[model samples]
Target: MADLFVAGGIVTALEDAAVAVGRLDAALAGNPLRRAWTFWSELDAARRHAGADGRKVDLFRLAAHLHGLPLRLGDTASAPERGREIAGLNYAIELRSWMAAPDREQQRLRDIALDSLRDCGGGQPALVATAQGMLEWLAGQGSRPAIRAAVPLYLRDRGITIHRLAAVTGGDSLRAGPVDPDGFTVRFLETVGREAAEGRDLLLTMEREWRQARLRVDHRAGARSNSRLPAAVDLLAASPLLSISALAEALGCSVEGASRMLEALVQLEVAAEVTGRTGRGARRLYGLKRLLPIRAETTAVQRRARGGPRGRPKRVLIAPFAELADDAGVADATPDAEPAEPTRLTAASFDFDALDRLIAAADERTRGVRRLLDRIARGDKPFPTADGTEEPGAA
Candidate 1:
């Protein structure tokens, strides 16, 4: 009965996956993540309610399970693809989410995808192997194809090449021949669509964050006599990463002047050189975090804090989790301290009236911090979160 139940679960997963892929166009057209996050949040809630099922499903696991479901269902006898799909989905989504995902994550997922593709080449059951092959090829999975197609169009815009990708493609090991495979283009388009939606959502998430962090291209506009330099600044706000030649074309300036302008941007910290150049014939790329493929959210805030009309902005220090004490202002004894019965924090659990009083006793500026937090708590202001959304009153 347990086996049958598990089999039924497998079937349900497969059908859901099929339904998702079939309706992916609509998913692409509307919000890509609305369905994705809702599905996992509900699944996780269900898991928590089921007492024994403490295991939580994160976005990565849920995406992998759903995206690679068709492949897993193809091989009931030897369904290793269940695990493999986790890697594939992780790779796909990470590429979508992060402009610069960690090196280890990139290598780990890429190796899994490559090995899985290679393994499926040998003779396998007809029905089982077809979906697996599609998984491997992912449209053009096993066969070597154009390397550019394998990379996101955004990355290609950054001037990806055989050498440039060596470091950024996730792993140190290099595979010769075509880096991109078939159907990779379609996969990338889907990923790009999702990425675009994510970027916009991130920008709109925090009104304060967006208002504070907008790269001020106009700061240098009046100082420069040349009209092209002002145009160049506008271009950077729209597209933060561009090649030297691309910048030249956009600015309608000579390469030497373009190089100078690019350097000026580097000095402004509005852009930075991303590639190392040799003596001659070296192509370089410059990037800013303000545009698509968004990087740090604190760029504008940090810049203003450093050079604002007011000397330096006051820094707020929140106690780290490690330093947080129990309700009675007591913590577990360390090895150096005498052991005592661990006390529970009772009064600290319910109301924060005492905490409010403590804050009220602080200096005027410090007390202002509480007012800011209270405003945040009441949904009166917007603040940024790590996941690119506003938690309204989470302050």
Candidate 2:
């Protein structure tokens, strides 16, 4: 809770988390091993839920940096490692998507990531290998309609280690393996693990319902599957966050036609415009309801426009290490330095005092969140009433 609050711009959360963890750390001071274990578990949960790692493309770039693998955005002569690592990460992520796809295709992509990992050389070889192992395990699994997710692999210098993530519940798994003990590894594990069952059901359910939605569209609009709008639905179902330009090209129609089809879906409540760009020439993205993050944070950039506190909360971007990897001259940035600490994820570098304060704020929010949850449990809504009074009262 503290990590989420802190990540979401709630300083109280950080203070609260620090305090809570400090107390726990002190309590378990007698047992050093247990203390470390608990600390790592709690910390990992926070980062994973907050998605500190980032999206698939973000992860590719992140891994390349963390492991000292170079990636270029130019046409200049790039090192062989740069291209190999980038290609490897891309294929690795693709393998995760194929976990629920056809078996033959999944195997094909799995081999690509493995071979790429083998070829690329730089820092954090163990981390790269561990990630490869996880992807290999997932690719080898039976074709069950599971949620597509990214798994964190430790790329720290020394040894390769995968996170040994347990199932959030029974029968939800992505081939278990050895894991690196850290504050952030478990966060990634639980985020993906807890969603495993739901993702499976969601994929299966969508497979059935999306087909029904398509059939309904065909029946009502009298459009064939191969037609502009109908064909585009297939693409939307596959990759929900689609652009007007991409849809237009896929449908072989004008961009206006693509926009029209999307608008039609919006009217039917089958899709929603995530970015509210309205100009004909402006950039935009459309996504299905299922693709949106569950209980997503309302960023400061998204003001209420109506009634609400207008205070800006600071948002923290997780930079695992210093400016060493982000440099364009990553190849010559610095001699590969083995991390001194255990890759502690408090990106702000919290000392004991800062952690305690952050955790204190977190404790208060924790109680507040619990109260809100209790209200929800009692069948109350978390919105305002007609009079704009906030409470668990009648709407």
- Clash count per candidate: 5, 25
RMSD of 2: 25.0
**Tens-digit per-residue lDDT, 153-258, candidate 1:** 2132323211111111211111122344323322323333333333223322222221222234445666655445544543443332355666676555678888
TM-score of each: 0.27, 0.32
Superposition TM-score, candidate 1 onto the true structure = 0.27
Scored by lDDT, model 1 comes in at 0.34
Please, what is the whole-model Cα lDDT of each candidate in the order they appear? Answer: 0.34, 0.38
Best-fitting candidate, scored by lDDT: 2
For residue 226, model 2's alpha carbon misses the true position, in angstroms, by: 6.5
Worst 10 residues of 1 by lDDT: 164-173
